[model samples]
Target chain A: AQRVTQPEKLLSVFKGAPVELKCNYSYSGSPELFWYVQYSRQRLQLLLRHISRESIKGFTADLNKGETSFHLKKPFAQEEDSAMYYCAPTPPTNAGKSTFGDGTTLTVKP
Target chain B: SAVISQKPSRDICQRGTSLTIQCQVDSQVTMMFWYRQQPGQSLTLIATANQGSEATYESGFVIDKFPISRPNLTFSTLTVSNMSPEDSSIYLCSGQTGFETQYFGPGTRLLVL
Candidate 1:
């Protein structure tokens, strides 16, 4: 069974502080992981993917296969960065069927 | 990325009633999926609407309770039957483009009374 675990259900940080949203997976095969963000009153949107290796909105995630983790990180958190984040792991064979992790609600305080 | 839209942005319905949610993608997408998000929970995939064929439902989701239709490549619909207070949640429709990135629609919020 492939499982994505986001241990932190809620995280709070002050503006300009570094933030990292933890995500761990229990998949045996190589997994393609992605981060999705949902701002207040906005639709859920893709933030970044491990395959892309490109940062979006100053957030980046690196796939750590040894540890089976893909943690999203940002150098400086902003008030606008307060949102819900989900970690999704998609198997190569199952491209559209991704197992999403329990989301983390990050609150960046001003 | 495709722009997805959902109908009946929010609704309040009584128990035992059914509500149909429509989804439309501005551009053609390779795959369409329906998901449910309970309050303060993660998104759980309901089914995959296959064009010109019966939908493939996920575990714990049945066709009779949540019938889905995808008559074309850019449109789909999901009907929640026999509603209850437990069914109150946000239902989202997503389109997976050729690039494999998913674009989600503004979900339809259903509140069962």
Candidate 2:
């Protein structure tokens, strides 16, 4: 079975500090990983995808196939960065479905 | 990027009632999906809304309980039947033009009493 694990359910950080949200996955086939964020009073939106090999809103995640990990990181946290983040991985089910992690609620304190 | 919209952004209903959520995409899309997020839980895919055909439901979900319709490339609907306290959740709709990424709609929040 395909599974994504986000160890932290809640993370707090002071503004201007670096932040990292760890994510691990278990899948036999080649995996596609992505990060989705949901801000307060807003719908879920894709922050970035490893396949894109790019950064968005200063957030970047590299797919470490050897370790089966895709961790989202940002250099400087801002108050606007506070949101619920999910590590989503596409399963090999050929169903166009993605399995999302439990999600980490990030709170950036000013 | 595709923009998606959902109708009746939030609704509160009594037990034994039903609610049909609508989804529309700004551009044509090849795939549409329905998901449910219960309080304090992760997003769970309820089914894949297939155009011009019946929906494909995931395990633990059934057509009898959550009927779905996708009449065209840019539109779909999900009906949550026999509502109960357990059915109170945020229902989300998503669409993708290609296989790479999916754009999500503003979810419909349902509260069953």
Best by DockQ: 1
Please compute and give the TM-score of the first chain of candidate 2 against the native first chain. 0.95
Candidate 1 lDDT by residue in tens digits, B49-110 = 99999999999999999999999999999999999999899999999876667899999999
After superposing candidate 1 on the true structure, give the runs of residues whose Cα lies further than 4 Å from its correct spot: A93-95
Q: Quantify all predictions' global Cα lDDT against the true fold.
A: 0.93, 0.90
lDDT per residue for candidate 2 within B1-113, as digits (tens), equals 89999998999999998899999999988788999987556899999999899999999999999999999999999999999989989999998656557789989999999
Model number with the top lDDT: 1
lDDT of 1 at A80: 98
Per-candidate interface DockQ score: 0.63, 0.50
Judged by DockQ cut-offs, the docking class of candidate 1 is medium
* Residue pair clashes in candidate 2: none
